[model samples]
Target: MKNTYITHALFMAMAASAFAVPSLAQETNAVADQADSGGLEEIVVSARRRNETVQDTPVAVTAISPSQLEASAALTIGDLQGAAPNVLITSAGTGAAAANISIRGIAFADIEKSFDPAVGVNIDGVYIGTSTGQMLDFFDIGSIEILRGPQGTLFGRNTIAGVVNIKRSRPTGEFGGKFEASYGSYDQMGLRGVLNVPVIKDVLAAKFFAFHNESDGYYKTVGTGQRRGGSNNENFGASFLFTPGDRFESLLTFDKQVQDFDPILGPLSRTGDAFAGALPAEFVDGNNTDNVYRVVAPSQQMVGTYSSPGVTNEMNLDLDVVKLTSVTAYRESDDQLRQDYSTTGLYFADRDQQYKQFSQELRASGKLFDGFDYVAGVYYFNSRYHIDQFTSVFFGAPTHQDTTGWSKSYAGFVDFNWEVMDKVRISGGGRYTYDKKKLQTAFTDPSNAGASFTGDKNSECWKKFTPKLGVDYRPNEDLMVYGSWSRGYRSGGFNGRGLTPFASALPYDPETVDAYEIGLKSEFFDRRLTLNLAAFYSDYQDIQQTTTVSVPGVALPQTIVSNAANAKIKGLEADFSAKPMDRLTVRGSVGYTDSKFKGFIVNQPVATGPTTSISRSFDFSAVDMIYAPKITASINAEYKLPLGPGDLKLNAGYRYLSRYDQQISADPALYPTALASAPTDIITVAQNDPRLRSDAQNLLDASVSYVFSLDNGLNYRLTGYVRNLLDDRGTNTSFVASNFPVYWGFATAREPRVFGVQLGVDF
Candidate 1:
């Protein structure tokens, strides 16, 4: 292990030297112009609800521009896996529209609407309440800002990890449009168009965009040859900017997206386990090999469909002394999924869900004194959801479950920044949040004479006051040092996936984190080299862990949520960018995280005999946290060459991630014992199971483009890109189900090598 760490360190150092800088571009300008100037351009960001240069923000943030996104071929949110430090984003496996996002060791992957994500995703200043439809496609985007660390004060609830703020391009009040088409591996095809028009000159401008993409899938089922991991997606949106006058402005935007796809699931059957004799022969024979792209199942294909519609209105009024802002938004989503979990095709499940949310925010910002600026806001959010699920286990009669839930949240926050001295500044903020949740569930079993049970409606409320304080000292024009401390909160909720009434009605406590961070931002070598570094430690308390527990009179273990652990997470991040020459630019970043559970005690069901069981407390404090990779690094380089009538651009990127635990109960010993005389070899084999761990991975991508213009004021570009150049098909996530009759698991693999070409025109 020590040798492996040393090797990784050396590789990172070499990659940094070879690449040299950050690839993210300035928000409002072209990077090529900056390269020509022989110095890095200042990046502007809105991390603090105001426009400020990144170097002056005193926060750890990375801003990605539209040109950078295009260069990296980031078509969707999941494509931004290694673009930032200490962040991970991937498909959730439940559906194509869902995402599992982790920032700085904090993550949540379940699809249950009752559960809240530690990280927040905001679009055009409107927060997405659920992870179900957060994997948004990229189109007509202006900027993407990744704020690392707790954003409790300004972002309010459930931002204990961080926030991804996406800003769409506003109407330009010009008559212009762009169209593009692309074709890639696996028969993938895409088309996109954007149009901008002035509704009324100097008063209103409108922008409209439409996009469509389809693919034939990467994996196939054994015997049937049914496709999996395929998707057909469509998205369209329109935004109208109403200026009316210089003192007031309003923007209204509407968007809708639809996804039709197949869920991805790779079965990993344990044929050598203690209960192997009880397993279906089909399962054992079908998954005898270790190929993640092929599976044995009875179903023709699993189906997943999702659709969401949303509308937002943002109005601003600028007074002489203060500026007032109001944001109102509403969104609705419908999701359907059919999956085969047992891999035998005989055991399958179906889910239908509907969700809706509404939010309103009012804020005011202005200079409060000679050196002080303040921003204050009041926010309200309400959401409701319903789910109907049916499952058939081990070829048994299907069971039905229905869940309904709602949440309401209210918050008040204030933040202020004061330059007390010439080179010293102080910032402080706080937010008080009150959240209320209600849940009800019903279950019916057909095998038990159609027995039905309904859980009583349960309601719960939680309140929290989170605060932040920071100070920064700038001793020179090109250098600044800052330190900060903050607290973040996530609300409590009932278990919506519970199989029994008692478990469904049970409530879990809220989770909170206290974080401390210090950082330095600097530039050297005549502004040609920029380096930023940060180190942070976070204390996580009352972690809401989702686990399985045995319920009396139930054949299968019930999924439950509990505040079962506390943790300590510390990390270091470094980012640098350099203009090595006039035509070549290099960017690189490295992140190191050390996450460990401080206290993890949970009750497990131990089988003493064939028909008897007992619950015992187990200490699992030594286990590693899920999705907490120890080391993550990336290097990217871009070179520009003057062609005959245009500029030729070549880009390459490499990303690396160390092995990390993908499941909470990764240790085989944490599994419930079958019996005292169980075969020891089965346990030993399970201990070395490769399906329980996500191995280290290295990925490479490259792209080339040629841009030119015609004399008629028309612009054209041609590009070729390839992702996963090395075809590293490592496990992205693993799901272990040891509480079942046998030790079985399923895993999702990273995307394979894909190459494509694209053509675009602007008129």
Candidate 2:
């Protein structure tokens, strides 16, 4: 029974850390003299790979500094999602290389290249395995953390729903620099820059950064009205720091990012209202107008494209007692997807995608005796992905799609923390991973459509060992309490846009998790109120889903990939902050997930003409759990006004997300099709069948800033923002079927009101 419930959760977390370490050092010296008044300051984190003080780190992280991501204009990572509570960064169809990050409610929204993404997108500490160009745009940042649950023994591969580190800003020996600019509202524009140099001063130093942005495309295109999800992008980076002594250090880096524009394709409305004439008249409804971010009749699109580049080499050595690190990395991306699924321009699609990666890591952290504290690591990874596509329907027939994929991994990890006494603390970690994958295909043979189908190969391998156990108790000095048990995995490939051979030769397995967490971190009154709480429970196995069948005389609809399903997730999170006066500050967060689906089955394709057989069986175990979402909340308020040349901040925030659903049988008898030729005219309602769900949102954002301060040591800042601010168009991604063989359900909207202005400088 799951190893007796993981050995009774590691013997009740080692008997509650050996009887709570003798009453937490006498209740932490009687609450350390009633906290001595103070509020909100310490906020350091590494989520256990080092650094501490996130209220003494019990995990369930959510850092986000850099002046709170520049007063929430966030510029990427899906605008850092309402202060992270059940995190969900998305983009699935636009810039930042189509991001789709998720945490807590693990997700892997497809963009296919051999899918794998259950949350894990590191940067700086390297690790960005695929998801082609996994969104990037926050330059020179110095923090971003967001580790929710199941971090798999010090972050080992696909963290099963958590992990998003992203630290930047290094190399600063002396000399400095900074710059910024912006202008917004549809014609948006932006620029940012930074520099730091002092070669050989502190043994060597150099750093640089740059970014540029453009906008104009929020949707609009109904028969050539051009514009659809816009934002041209550019970025550049550099780093070089060599300490050369003093506990040895080194860092060498390089970066590049580029993005052309236009591409969000999701606008051919007509959802609900049972059948609405069963769609397909170029998607009914006045040929595209009922503006849900508009876009009707678009075809043969083309604009920027996309490209990404990266390189890194990091090293550290303080080997006195321990502490040695090394990291080597390389990354690459290239893409071009000119889509226009007949939103008018009459059917078009030209696609291409590519990615490459290499990674290496080695580490050894300090203090392994006395009070204990340690870390050990080893990892190596490799990646490659490819795809090509072509289509042009309009009057019919014209197709091609190709694929190539690869992956490799090896890992070993360790972590430990003792402090067996003095207010308790005990931890453990483990990792063993080993994975391999391969897939290849180049098509043109939908059963002889043009006769061509090379050896379509496939390969797979996986191994796992994930583990972690923890306990923390501080009883006083502002309180702290914790518990944890973790495990995570996600690896298994094949099915890069399948169409035959049982969908790309078949391969799918690795997808495991087992997490349990409990937490509490407090700092009442004296600390001016700071509260944190967490609760989690997870258990998923062999659940890598991705389906879209239909083969009876197919003309596209394969896209397989399966491991059936099995799930059970739970959650509860909370975070708070308050200042009440001292310039007023108040933050908030709340989350509650429940997810279901304990089993599922599938095998579809109902009826079609001439030589077409039938097979149907759908069981979605009462579906529900795609983008999890059972309730999410957020609130923020910042105030400060002593204006007249400096200090004048004002910000507002509010967020909520409740309803959710994106796939897994939105019903229609599991999507039939083939409307004509027998079997009772087989057609099962259209446009994202099963009732595309998703509604329940309340976003609102605002900002205002002013800093100014001069006298040689410069400082100046100005800001003004408003995102969404109540221009909710909701539905951020839905679908019934498209890109051939239609069904009429399409969606994608969110990002309506936006207004901006920013300027900065600091020396």
The lDDT of each candidate is 0.79, 0.71
TM-score of each: 0.92, 0.33
| Per-residue lDDT of model 1, residues 1-763, tens digit only | 2322332343334233223422311112134424565688778898999899888889899887777777767788888887888988877776547778888999987778988888899989988888878877785688899999989877535499999998888887866666677899988887777766679999999987777777988777677887667888877778999999999999999988888887767765565543345545544533322366776654435778888989999999999699999999999999998887535554577889999999999999999888899999999999999999888766688889999999999999999999999999999999999999999999998876434688899999999999999999999999999999999899999998877876889999999999999999999888788899999999999999987654545555578789999999999999888887887888888999998886677665655443466655556677678787899899988888899888898999999888777766534444444334244322221222345567777889999999887655556779999998988776666675644233466677678899999887665
Best by TM-score: 1
lDDT tens digits, residue span 1-763, model 2: 2322332343344333323443221111101111223566777778777998788888788787777668768787778765778777667763237777767777878777577778888888887875657678785777878888767766546478888888888877766566677888888887767666577888999877767777887777656776667767776767899887899988998877777776755554454323335334545443222354666545344554877878898889886899888889887888787765424444456787778888888988988688898898888888887878866544356668778888898888888889889999888878898898988886774345544566456788888888788889997889899998888888887878775666787888888888899899998877788889999988888898887654555455566778888888888999888886676777888988887776576555644443364654555666676777888888888777777866788888888888677665435533333332344342332223433566677888888989776544556788999887888775676655531223445566667788998987656
Which stretches of candidate 1 lie above 4 Å from their native place? 1-33, 223-226, 272-290, 449-451, 550-552, 607-611, 669-690, 738-743
C-alpha RMSD by candidate, in order: 8.7, 23.8
Q: Total backbone clashes of model 1? A: 7
Q: After superposition, how far is residue 493 of candidate 2 from its true place, in Å?
A: 2.8
